[model samples]
Target: MFFNRQEIKFMFDENKRLNSKVKEFAKKNFHPKNFLFFSDSGSGKTTIAEKLAEELAKRREICYKSNDSKFIDYTNQEVLVKQELIHNTWLLKELLNLCEKDICPMNCKGKTKIDVMTKYNIITAQDPFDDIFNFKKRIFDENPAYSKDKRIGLHRRFSKSKDYTHGYMFKVTNRYQSGKVDFQITCLKESDDSAGDINDFVNGRFDIKFAEETTLEEAKKRVYDDDFENLYKHKGDVFLKREVDMDHVLGGVICDVDTENHTFSVYNKYFDSEIPSTMIPPKDLNRLNERLRNKIINQFGPDHEITGTNKRT
Candidate 1:
């Protein structure tokens, strides 16, 4: 099936709305308690972080670094905080240990932070690309709900004879198509240098991250996606959702909140598919997906539908 513009536009619009809500929160809790980069489904938290950094750019600059810094110790990257963190210094050095400058083709290989940022135009003060591709599989599988934009998808990089993006390369893995949409789903690892760099600079920085055709989940991850889902009350609505019918089961949803204008939204699948019923203690999604488990029946099993229905993966 071709890409649906309405879904993409709708998601983008939700991003704008979510951005406003985040700004409000920033205004309320603008202090340096800590830099919070989070979101549920359509609440572009990372997008906001990049934008905030971009706005901060008016005053300062931004840097991006590979997430490996979190795992590795003794990272050469300046943003690599010396204090004990998620990843140790040895791990950091071990990771970049061999990154050995992109120039040394003989020793160095794979995409660099600069490589990915340049492609995406994210001028963070630190580099965060090297490890981005590392967790591609998990990022694509669990986080972000995406809808490919065909027009832009048709738009190709200057080098490619035909567009060479889609899930295969970026790891978005659109189950709908044999080849997935690259820009459709993105990776959002919380322990990223991008945000850390912003925190490093108390002054902050201005940054614009156009995660075009990607979902907030893929762009950010469970850490922020979880925050985004619960960040709805302030939006002046009750139920807010972003409907995407690209990959995995159904689309995404932003449920439970009596906000103002825009409240709730669900994936095209929920809209397209008829609601299924559940008896007593129904099945969890894990069991349902297991074809062997005749014990599990419908897709919206008890766990996924009633309890675990906040968002779709």
Candidate 2:
């Protein structure tokens, strides 16, 4: 909700564009591919990427059951849905299952568990880069029980499969709330053999870059200004003047307007507390009550009681 409708739409479209590029590569190469997205903290990259993942999973007939934390592949009834309690373990099991048969995992009977991992998979590995190396070793080199021919078959199936889709989310800049690890290092290493930088997919590198950063305070101010403008158009200057004067007298910021209580709450930064409407001047308080009463009358055909205003309506 921090972004407006148009902003949200653009974010979704941009991610879809990136996904399309991955799909195009998969189609042409007949191999699985992944993507990496980098942006500053609080840029909503995770939100947008997760949404695209969910959408793609649904298209692939894969859905996640939150109660059991398992991704169910509705298309493949034979494969059991595994609970994703451990990332590395879950990934290992899925890949091992794919290797159970010699056929390409992409053209197998049903969608793979990797298809339903909307949150984070190998593509978004936040752990150390060694984890990836360990995974490769486990799959192809570490296991001694399997014959050399079996290991080679597994590697061929995995490398040739065109069904895998993954995305990596990385923050270009760190903030107070962001993690300290540099994910770009992992992303670059992962993409070294897969798809190149995102800019390679889209023409004009500027199109792939994120917009200018907007701070939380600046976003809130934009919402406040839009609300104030709309309210002024409806209620005129008298109501607006009283609201401003009340803010000045209370020496606090108007945090919220509680229409149901017929009061506007103010937050005093000095004391870190909210000032009650009782602290407002009697004249301004009366004007606010009158405004609410008029609003109720005009909305409810002038038959509603003065104290019977419903905020929901």
Candidate 3:
């Protein structure tokens, strides 16, 4: 428990070095809004995540506060560590809590708050892909009306546009379960036309210009020929059409930490790619992972497999 001056200095230098490495890693990977940290149950993923979050808070001049597994709040930004899968309902609750506190300075209102409110968030999980997929499913399931609408359905399935800055028009066709087929056009961005279309759709009126049902051939022609000019004839300026996946909507960076190997890697699900791993000092890894294991066993019980195979005797 007692360390000489030299030993104390060595510890300080090592801690500083590790902090620098973590900051650099974050700068390179934390662009997306949603990020994940995955590894073995006792890999110290949460510990590293907390450190990263703290460093970010310091850099962003935000308050760093955490309440166990609930969330590591960093004012506008946060690291979500709730010991459960990330789903729409849970996420909405957490976001509302964050918003209610009015911690962030941004004055977001209405649907935009639900869609693109947060500046950044980190979600800790064991399986990143499964969590991401489940989150998207929850979104669709909870909003059945939106899911059934041809425009929303097609936008959810085929829209790959990542340009969040501009508006968009999606034209597609599908057969309903009632044995009725129709081509539908819808606008995704916030605009007068899109707003009117949404109001009409909600009021049981499909007479809006944007919700017009046309032939499949015509829809294909507009989509394939990049026919924004004709489509937006009276609407507004032309907007680009692209796929907008869930990853884009829930943007963030993901980091996968490997405690056994004393390294951590970053991943951006939107790009579907993995960044290389950065080596952690073995001493730091051993100390953090041991602390994490003990904490997990204490919280979840010794029988929890995360405590590792060698059970306490």
Task: List TM-scores for all candidates, in order.
Answer: 0.17, 0.27, 0.26
Which model scores highest in TM-score?
A: 2
Q: Write the per-residue lDDT of candidate 2 for residues 165-240, one digit (tens) a residue.
A: 2222233333313211122312232222222232211110111111124333432332224434322212111111
lDDT to native, each model: 0.26, 0.30, 0.30
Sort order, lDDT high to low = 3, 2, 1
Over the stretch 1-313, how does candidate 3's per-residue lDDT look in tens digits?
8999999999999999988877421111011222234433544445444554443233334333333323333333332223323444233334333322213222232323322223224344454323323324245544322222333422222112232211112121221221111212233342223211211111111111122334334434323244343233124223222221111121222123332322222222222222222211121212223444343345445543322321211
Misplaced by over 4 Å in model 1 are 1-33, 70-313
Q: Order the candidates by TM-score, highest first.
A: 2, 3, 1
Q: Score residue 155 of candidate 1 by CA lDDT.
A: 16
Answer with 2 or 3, whichever has the higher TM-score: 2
Q: How accurate locally is residue 164 in candidate 1, as Cα lDDT from 0 to 100?
A: 17
